[model samples]
Target: MAIALNTKLAEGVQKAAAEAGLAVVNGQESAGFNGIPTEKYTLALVSAPEGHTFTLELSAGFDITAANIAPAVRAYLLESAKRLTNPRPDVFVTLGGLPVSFTNWQWPFHLSVSGADTYVVHGGATLEDGKTAADQYLKAKVSASMTVTFAEVVAAPEQPFAEGFIYNAVRKILDQGQMELTKSGGNRQVVPVTTRYYSAKQGKFIFNDTTAQQRADYLLSKIYWLSGVLGGGAPVWIADPRDAQYLNTTVEELKKTAESLAGEGILKLDPKFEYASSTEPLMAHHAEYEHHLQDALDFTRPTFNEEMRAGHTNM
Candidate 1:
């Protein structure tokens, strides 16, 4: 039998999800990284587009019954509804201009018992090259310090407060060439999570400083990697908040960029004008996108002088 869910948390989450045009398709008890009990919900958009019925997994291991926690959870669920409309909600783009798919995430944050003042969440991110073996992935441990947890993040180490920056920190690490997605045998890498990725002043997360052209290129590359390559030419949500946060831009700007691409015959917008499918013009740039992906992968790889380390060469 499954464990019982916290009444207040379940009610609030369901209410928030409904208000955001989502429905709780399923709910059940789940376990966390260390076998901690959790409440897991499968959320889906009520009016999801045909050929796309994206489901998002939301798991809570902390006490979310507090009034203060409600607002953050509400905001997260609302944003999640928007994000699920994305062609691939699980995939995130790195500043290296690569798209990586994150999955098998051990949801919610767990407090450290090693006398460390921190909380951590574990997950895996796979490079979506369409050619790499699925078993290869980057094992990531996202951590939050006690100071930032109380100061910027909510008092509780919940999904709503920690998920956004955790995702951004993974992208940041990839951009800085700090971590690499490897085969299954590799050890988990730590992605130090902090509020530096969050802007309390702006009331949002900040990952990269991108220009308009850069953003445009990112959208095009997203379409190429996700839709053209992985999604069977399906449409992708252009106004994704995750992308907005990653690019440090607004959803409206993303819409405008999509419209621009549509105007240029690079994209075909759906009737709603929010989602767009790649056109032949966009697909024709496959070689260019392949080149960009190769460049990004190379840039994210670290270089070391093996010969010098082996005493085969002088410093």
Candidate 2:
């Protein structure tokens, strides 16, 4: 059977991958991200020849090409494996969400006491008593000095980002961005985490802290109010499909489930990257590179799931 996939799924997968790429570009860690950055994620397409039905599913923890993909994808996969050459029933696809895994946190802390006085200088007391006998100008002074000490607590950012939701939102943004690319070349390139640190201890802080903060703020701006302009973090735009309460289980499990469909022969996993860029934010344009990479994601994306699961609502 010739099936048409939903563009939303492709949109979700692509957005997620691009965001992953963004994390590496910004010199942030992507691995500890609850498996969103892992290579285990998968997308599957399954076929059911006997029933003349097709299925598409996303696995939780395994690769889409592996033998443990989701049930629906398995059906379509087997169907594709069978002898069906009329319309050449196999199709390739991808999707995305957003890019920035975490938003910009101001993380305000007092680096200096009133900031001006980073040090204290001890001043010796001046002696002013003179001419004690006949006519004298009386003056008394205490020989006391002042000592300066510095104190500050370790300061860092704390995020309230919902782990699964953040990933899901980014996936959607990237998936939408993917539709604009040509398979040959020109992808959203992410800077490696090895690039540079924007934090204060780098000693580079004296000159660039403001600049770094500005850059961080700029990228965050794109995801925030602007996201409303594009539709982000919304209940309808930011829920991960792996919600067992809503779907069946966790994304990790779903990934494995999605991967098994490949054994059944219909699913395919594409190692792809999503790159985000905007003409605005003159500062972010210069921070990471010549332009601002709003966010990026790398994933074993689901392309056919876009086709089969077209009826469901995205969040």
Candidate 3:
């Protein structure tokens, strides 16, 4: 079975190469009877440039099948195109006060065959050998030459706040019950709980059921506090005009501070703020809330709140 599959694969590759206007010849031939190649072939020849030509060998265990061979051949052709088009970059790393350079010229192309996944190997045993062989082959066939260069190291600027600060702040707000966290599952997975609030102001500013007037007051208080801490020019409110009652300072300064805090990773105060208008209404969004409550009941098995317990009794 294995030998037949191997033969079929070799024939498919040979046919595919022939159709692509390339001549492919078997590398391993039988010792007797007109030197015919063995069914378990080892090598092949393709028409390439004179001095740049290199051999590409694809080998598999005897259990290999024709389905396996087809994708391997396709991957080989694709890899060849990639090498010719966007040659891999050279990398440099520092170790012990010395700069070490390395080049990667080959990549593994994965394919699934007969419900089993397999990878097609490029070059020979090692990457260096593959690079040399591929470079030679490309040079002879297409006069292609690859350049070697040093890699640059880029350091990200340090942030002002600790890592996960925004995540922790959001989680803390959720825990405070400012918004509802409902979990629902589908598609063989549990979707992240949807965080819903009655108003967009609540969603963005992390406020509870405060009235719009109260929110405006709260904003003014925050601006004053921020101004004191930031050494008091006039207090600036970087809030939507519809939501703002007190605008003692220019919107430009508000935007400037917002941008600075966001860049320093201290806060994310941009378009997420614009999402305030789409806030879900309380009680009307009961289907999602019930789904989440049921999920909680099944998983945690905790005592229900009076409302939930009474509802269950009615049901």
Candidate 4:
């Protein structure tokens, strides 16, 4: 049987993409999404002028027929474009300064088998230590659970609503040393999605409480790893939603911060001022950034009780 395109979703996505300076060059129907058997519509989007391309996987389960969905889709597409302007759109940094890339994430939350009154999504993340060999990198299976209460307020259990917070939650867990990313034989890591992460009054997700200086430091580090090192000095998008959410601020604030950095000659903004690249002065602090990376790696390393390891304790 041939699967028909969801016209509602396609129209919404096309309109949103166009307004975001992107184009839906093509779309295809899939038998499943992230291995779960269900119809999926994956759109291939291209950013004009630069021609950078990325894919967005949308599940058929979204309530696209709803009138309110249009605005949500538009917002998501804009943020999605901003994220792709990153040299490594899939990678995000932890509070510990470690960069992790979450990939192959499943879409549309599934009911919990344990009947815990929650919905769950599954994915995988890898420690992206550019300095380390690929085979030596640490990896983890990620699952995030959203409480039924929290889920009710969500517009949809789609990428837009869940991805940002889920990524932030993973960073929080890694920073707190609650989750382990191992080189081999790792178990699933769960990120609890609770009401604490959302603000009903504000109607948005709140992850971190950061200051201007902290935000500046984060941008600097982001450029260091994502642009200076991995991207070969390519300009990266400054107004990223993921970063804004992680820092607990607005995209406008981040743009203002980027402008400030540009004025100091620490960064060079593109002609459009939408993207930023590291300057000589910024890259000059390579040693400092490297130290921070090493510190983060040390912080996330698993610690064992020496006495227990020596068989000196009984439970």
Q: Pick by lDDT: which candidate is best?
A: 4
Judged by whole-model lDDT over C-alpha atoms, candidate 1 comes out at: 0.70
Which predicted model would earn the best TM-score?
4
Per-residue lDDT of 4 in model 3: 31
- TM-score against truth, every candidate: 0.83, 0.17, 0.20, 0.85
By summed lDDT, the worst window of 10 consecutive residues in model 3 runs over 150-159
Root-mean-square deviation of Cα positions for candidate 4 versus the true structure, in angstroms? 3.5
Error of 3 at 177 (Å): 50
Pairs in steric clash, model 3: 49-140, 49-141, 52-136, 52-137, 52-140, 200-276
> Best to worst by TM-score, what's the order?
4, 1, 3, 2
- Which regions of candidate 1 are displaced past 4 Å? 1-6, 47-67, 135-151, 305-315
Clashing pairs in 1: none
Error of 2 at 39 (Å): 7.7
lDDT string for model 3 (18-116, tens) is: 443334434332221112222323222244322112223232222123464445454444333222211111111110111111222121121222233
Residue 111 of model 1: what lDDT? 68
Residue 87 displacement in candidate 2 (angstroms): 35
Q: After superposition, how far is residue 255 of candidate 2 from its true place, in Å?
A: 33
User: Which residue pairs come into collision in candidate 4?
Assistant: none
Q: What is the alpha-carbon RMSD of candidate 1 to the true structure?
A: 3.7
TM-score, cand. 4 vs. native: 0.85
**Model 4 off-target regions past 4 Å?**
1-19, 24-37, 41-53, 61-65, 271-273, 306-315
